[model samples]
Target: MSALDKALNYSKKVGINECEIVFIKKKTTTARITDSRIVEIKHNFDEDYGIRVIHEKKIASVRTTKPQEIEKTIDLALKSASGVRPRNFWRGLPENIASNQLSGVYDEKLHKISAKETMDIAQIMINSAENSKINTITGSLNIVSENFTIVNSNGLNVEDNATYISGIINAESEQSTIPVSGIGHVSSRTLKSFSPEQIGNEAQIMCTKSINPQKVDSGKYSIIFEPYSVGELLAFVVASNFNFKTFTEKKSCFSNNFQEEIAVNQLNLIDDPHIPEGLGTKSFDDEGIKTQKIKLIENGIFKNTFSNLFDSYKEGKYSTGNAIRIGSPMGRSSEPIPSCAPHNIKINSGDRSQEEMIKNTSNGLLVGRLWYTYAVNPIKGDFSCTARSGIRIIKDGRIIGPGKSVRIIHSLPKMLKNISEIGNDQRNVIQWASLPSITPSIKVEEITVNSI
Candidate 1:
């Protein structure tokens, strides 16, 4: 019998009321580059199982990699469940099992990529930076192939295959007395969608432009946030405010603003799990619930929130198929308990081009990336972040010169309402395993930038 079958049968023998087992096998290959050369190449293969047992509305979980020890793990879970209070709002696992497929989620080329191929890609990126006169280049290339299977006693059996390729390139120019760095990154589900040369070139350009910096007075000014910067802000400050659990508990910024205009009329956001080449694309969630496209914000109005089974049960609502095993800084793990998270956050493109937004700005700061961003007061939508690199000052509808690092303290809802222009150059971005977003450059008026 298969491992899943064995686990389920053993659960039945133990007289468990309900059981679910998630089996995941993954292969990862990584190449690291430093000083414009390949520094290390590593490969890893991992397999793990996460088991959940429910007895009389009491739920317990266990995770292990050893197949022979699954029974012991299950027993331990049962023991744990016996000591815990029953969940009053516990709802049964999903019962419907259907066949579904997502396009561009699995690619044979990415799964079959070898160490040499990854090294070659790294070399190409390094060469591109070097060609642009960058003094140093550091980056990493990661390729992953994962097999996920979910089986539960409620007649749910599902399996999926997925592949991911991601790369980041950072360039530094030694010509300057103070070191300045630029970063470029690409994340995709297919191999052909990545462009190492483009990543390298963009980093090189940013590094070159940031050779010498000027300081600006601390004041409110127009700010143009590039896609990557917007992604960082969304990941750290805005994303969690839409959680159903948090909203229902009155802990989110949007708790009292549902169905209200929280942003400008041009702003629309969607959580889509079926976008082609999206890094988070999947047919179903971790709980074996079918995934669907959800409109979180429509024409500036807060529309809907995402939820997992537990949260849905608590709210007396159906699952939105947003159950996700929280991943680490590197990527997704198979051992963690499921929670609600967005799949691929797509911000609808606007009519204005990036060039037009820049040309029309009379006075503003152009930010290519943001770092060390976090919510200072999530309930109040207040946040702080640093413009670490690729910051340029715009004057009279033209870029004057690069600017020094600055800190921004702002409010999320107010900033969303202050959006004056949005660019059409939308790009896919993944920030430290936190958020997978497709966004475009945006210009927000009267943001507070402080000199530090």
Candidate 2:
């Protein structure tokens, strides 16, 4: 029997009214860079199945690596649900939703991307940097083979599979303007399908920019956030904001601001998992819900919030198919029941050039990325973070010098209102996050920049 069939038949047999199965399999390899060369490599392969059952107002989750364990797990799930307290706002499970067949996000050739291919690319990066006075090179490649099956007790079944190839490169330079920069990224379900030369050149440029970073006095200024740097902010947004649960819990700033034109009426933020070959691409979500593109911010106005099956049932809204289960082998958690979260949050890019935006600034900071950011209040959108790689710029378009641990304390809505410009430059970033969030570089006029 198929995974969906297994989940459905088991739920009925166990006297449980509703159930869902999330089945996933993955294979991957990763390599690290040290002393300007690869010093380590690791390979991993994992396969597992999890069942979540909601019966008689209670929910139970169980998982097993071996198929033999599925029956026991199902039995345990039903028994556990029976004895447990009813859910806080218990509602019946959902029917399996169907989705439009989309292309460009899955690859049939991902497994063919060999270890030899990655090793060759790593060598090229090292050689290029060494030739440019960038005496050292450090980087990594992550490739994965993933298959997923989502099924529910309701008439729902999904079969999805894809491959992913991604690379992260970091390089340091002898100059100071851009001392340490080299954020490289490419994702597709296929091997060697991304541009090595394009990403390589990016790393080279960022390293060069930081080599001799300029510095200016700390104060209010116009700030231009590069694409990779903005990605850090997107990660935070996906993690804390835009969730219907968070909104109901009074933990989201966008809750009260819905339909309000908060930004420049030109900016939009969208979460999309349907892009072909995208690392976050999927045909169905954790709840066996079909997925689609969702606009969180439309023309600078806050749009509707996202609700998963269970959450929507409680919130009295239709599901938006934004059910993401993070951190455990492609959404398979052996121990914890997965919660619905966002997959890809992208800030629509604006039309201004990076240089033009910089020149428009009389005095301000130019941030490469945000680091160590934390929320003071998700409802109010207050955040505090340090500038990771950047310079303080003055009116004449001159960057003064590189900054050290510069701090920025600001509010999200206020910052959006300060949108003086958004650059045409964009990038896909995977920072130190649970999952990478896609974003574009942006600029806001007169954000209070301070470091004493």
Candidate 3:
């Protein structure tokens, strides 16, 4: 029997009303440059099993890296499901989907780059940054390739995989600092698209700006966010809501606001895993179901959520191909629970130069970078963050000095509605040391800041 067939037979033999098995295998090689020196060269292999069992329409899940422990894990899941109450909302899986290719999501060179090549790239960043305006450089380059298989009793057998390579570099100075980073997205199928030097230079510029920062008074002011910062804002607005399981269970802030538009009418958020050469691209979710590019928000209206097979079954809806079985610390729960979550995310582009956005602000803060951000509530859009790599924008179009760290406390809707302009510079921000999100600079009318 195939992997899916074995999984299904195991479920039936074990008296499981329904069951699904997800298998994931991954390999990664990483290179990091520190102070013009290659500091780290590492490679890792990962594999895991995610199993779900249903009883009385209730669901319980667990993942195990040890094959020996899977039976016990399944027992725990079955017991958990049996103890819980069932709901009609436990819809069945979607019908069989024909196989389709969502290629161009991985790159081979990123994974196979020689140690010499990787270290040389890092050396370039350190040398260039130290030479360019007072700046310090820190960066990492990661090449990852993964494959996943989904098998279930319901004749659902799906398999897909992709490759991704990404890097991040930062240049900071005590004098004037503006955080800037470079990013690119392509599949192992596409090599000409990857550029490591480009990423290095972007970081160098932001770090050099740290020379002489202008200290401005703290207060509510108009603001513009750079690409990574923009991605941060969008992740808070877009990803939180799609976390349906978290929201519905009250584990997330977006749990309460189920019926509302949470962004400006001009804002559109999407998860485009199907985009050619985009990171986090996949053909099927953890459930072996075909994946899709879900438009989470359109014209500021809240659309559907991203859910895994179990969540889809629980909510009586279709799967969003958002399930990630395992990888990273949070991708798998601290406990043995199934690891399912969103992967690729893309925001529709907006057109306007950074200079134009600054000019549009009249008088406000030019936010260069954001740090120390956490969501007070994902559903409600409550956030607090610090500002760096910033400057004060006067009535004229010229740039000034640094702005103080301010607290951005507001719901997603109000915050996005305050957008006065958007930048023409769009950034691909994966491997941001967090979730991958693509974003551009955005201007907001006012943001509240408090002094230390």
Candidate 4:
């Protein structure tokens, strides 16, 4: 029997009313690049098990890396449960989980990749940037394989395997004196779709374009946000506004706006977990609930919010299969308990191409990426962020020149409503410590940009 099975059986023997155990194993290969060369390669292997026990509606959880310590961990969890107050809204663990397979989420070759191979890929990326006349290239590549097993006292048992490859590359122009830089990134479930060369080339091109940048006056002006910037905005500022817990507690800006139009009539957003090769694709969520596509906004109308088991129970709703545990830096982990989070947030593509959007703009700023983005006042949909790199000014539907960093203070709801155009060129992107998203370039009208 697996550790999960043994733990569940032991919990039953100890008279625990209900329990769930999750086991996770991860293998990771990482390569760090600096100054157009491979600097280091590291390999890691980790395994951990987490157990949750419920006694008379009280819940407690414990995690441990040592298999031999499972018994002690259970005892600790039970002891912890004793002091906790019973939750009247607590519902039992999910049962009768169906076995389903998600395509493009697992690759045997990724599991077999070696440290040398990862390093070689990293080297190729650096070389590509150097060949483009970049003075410096720096980034990290991570290849991960994960194994998961879930078991509960309700006779639910399931296992899943997945692979991921992700990288970030930055390039600096050789002739630029202002320390301009560009960044590119990629994430995929298989090595076949991973492209280190494309990442490097993109960074190099952006860095070259950003040399000797000028400063634009701070004022209200139209703005174009590239795919990466859109990902940053949504992941950090917008996604949480649809959390069932936050909505139910009246802490979200959209709390009372359900079924109302909150954005442009052309806007549609979906939380999809079954997208092929998507970074967030999964067949089942952390609670062993089947995952499905959820239309968060349909034609600018707020359609639904995401919920995990606990939050759903609190609101007397069913789980949306949005239960998630924040993965470790290297990959998946069993250390954290489940919470509500988006899977793959897909902003439906629009009709206009990026070039068309740029050509049609009379005067605006194009932001390639956003830095240090956060919600200044979440309840009011107020957001603040910095456009630090890859910024360009547009004048009379022409690219004028690159611009220096600028700060933006905007309202999310107002910005969404002011969207004038959306590009069809969607790209998959994940911001730092945020959810994965697929987005395209979007143009918004009259945003507040401030000099900093």
Clashing pairs in 1: none
Q: Rate the local accuracy (lDDT) of all candidates.
A: 0.87, 0.68, 0.62, 0.87
- Candidate 3 structure quality by residue, lDDT tens digits, 1-452: 45445556667888887777777677766777665556898878788777877677887878788766666777888988877788667666545667676657655665466767766755655555564454346667666666666666677776665666666666555443433332222122344666665666655565554445555666677777777777666555446656778767776554554546766777777877666665555676555566777777777776756777667667666666676654541122112234455565666768888777766665677665666677776656677776644444445555665444455565555676787676767656643545566666777876776543
List, residue by residue over 193-226, the lDDT tens digit for candidate 4: 8998888877887788899889879998789999
Name the regions of candidate 1 deviating beyond 4 angstroms: 131-133, 327-332
What's the C-alpha lDDT at position 231 in model 4?
Answer: 96
How many clashes in each structure?
0, 28, 22, 0
Off by over 4 Å in 3: 1-8, 56-58, 66-89, 93-95, 132-135, 174-191, 242-263, 312-315, 329-343, 377-380, 390-395, 431-433
- Tell me how far the alpha carbon of residue 150 in candidate 1 is from the true structure, in angstroms, after superposition: 0.6
* Quality of model 2 by C-alpha lDDT: 0.68
* Candidates' RMSD to native: 1.3, 2.8, 4.1, 1.2
lDDT of 1 at 19: 90
TM-score of 2: 0.90
Better of 2 and 4 by TM-score: 4
TM-scores, each model vs. reference: 0.98, 0.90, 0.83, 0.98
